[model samples]
Target: MDDQQFRQLLNRFGFSWSGYRKVRKGVKKRITKHMNALGCYNITTYLAELDKSDEVRKKCELLLTVSISRFFRDREFWKSLEKKYLPDLIDKNIEKINVWSAGCACGDEVYSFKIVWDCLRNSLGHLPKLEVIATDINPVYLEKACAGIYSSSSLKEVTEELQSTYFIKKKGKKRFEVNALLKKDVIWKTHHLLSDPPESKFDIIFLRNNVLTYYEDLLKKKAFRKILDSLAPYGFLIIGSHESLPFEPKDLIAIAPHSFVFRKEAE
Candidate 1:
């Protein structure tokens, strides 16, 4: 589709310009493939077909959702979480600690947190009840994540020690399957950040890279408000290292220097 037509289509779905820009090239490729499958030779026909078919529209939405991610994608951020954040959070909460890994693509981020928590638990000699909720809008991603299998590349940041402890090498393959222990407390679901309400109160919300980076100002604000409301007092909100809040919530304050981690001010 042409730029104007594409923009109009995305606007209809409440997707912002920033989100469109991030995935424009990939969207175009997906659309062209779909158009060919539908035997449509032009953007006009394709748009008309998309308007009429719920399946086609859903496919487009999946195409636009950014899913690029890896296990422990940013080394330093995980270090900060394990060495600094988790210790403090564990000390403060006596009940089950709830963690929501929003937009958890292919489950790497969720598993990453479990690995860190497991390591910390070993040293502390005590552990809180832990429950992890991993959500994504894309069911395909959710399916893959549920399988808990990954290529060696996706595990690049995982140390040899961790890999040996937490993953099983597929006997004759390069892929690794996450150990069953790590999957015990994780719950996965399909959710849209803007349209869906918060699932539950969370001590830590990994609201990274996706919505905040792709959404326009208005949607970002709305999503941020929802996230803030779901956060427990003094809860942590972690965004991508490169991302910043479009407008900070009154109760959420940045906690770590040069990091996107924030803490909800306790009342």
Candidate 2:
């Protein structure tokens, strides 16, 4: 299909321009397959066919969903969260702590947070009431995440200590199983970042690599504002090392190097 029609088709599914470019590379094949299944030849005809049928819409969504992830993909970021942010947060409140792992593909990052919390809890003797909300727009990935089974490839960045402590060796394979205790603290749900209201304010919001890069400047600003608004006083916002919010609000204090941590300055 032409660029305009292609853009509109993807936009209808909540994808942005950057998203279209990132996905268009591999997606053309899937689009062709879906088109073949629907007996259409081009993206224009394929989208038209999909709009006419709910089954085709579902098929298209399944084809378009992206789920690339790994445990502790940025090792230093997790270390900083554990050593600096979590301790600071723990010191502030022992009763409640909320962490949101936005765009948590296959729940690796959610489990990573749980692992960090468990380590701190062991050393601290008592821990805050910790809750990790893991969200993704893809229902299929959310289901796999909730199932808590992962391939060894997904755990490449997981440290040896964590592998030994939090995962049991699966029989006859390179994969390790996620501990059940960590799973208890994490809640997986399908959430559309652009359309859905922030369900609750979080003490730490991990809106990592993928979602930040998939929008124009205006949408990026809106996303940053929304994420900031959902953060509590002294809350943390961690993005990919390369991705940054368009404008830094005065309220958000930079945490050196790359990260930004904010304290609520006004209601």
Q: Which ten residues in a row have the lowest lDDT in candidate 1?
A: 13-22
Q: Residue by residue across 1-267, what tens digits does model 1's lDDT show?
A: 778867776676667776567678888778778779899888778778879999988887787787888999878889888889888888886578999999998999999999999999898878899999999999999999999999999999999999999999998999999999999999999998887555678999998888887777778888888877899987999999888887867888888563599998888
What overall lDDT, based on C-alpha atoms, would model 2 receive against the true structure? 0.76
lDDT of every model, 2 decimals: 0.86, 0.76
What stretches of model 2 exceed 4 Å from their correct place? 1-24, 50-62, 260-267
lDDT of 2 by residue, 1-267 (tens): 556756776676655666557667676567666678778876677777778989888778667666777888778878877787789878876478988888887888888888888888887778878778888878888998987788888888887888988898889987778999988977888886665545788888888765566665666676667777788877888876767777868887777654544444534
Clashes of each: 0, 2
Index of the highest-lDDT prediction: 1
Clashing pairs in 1: none
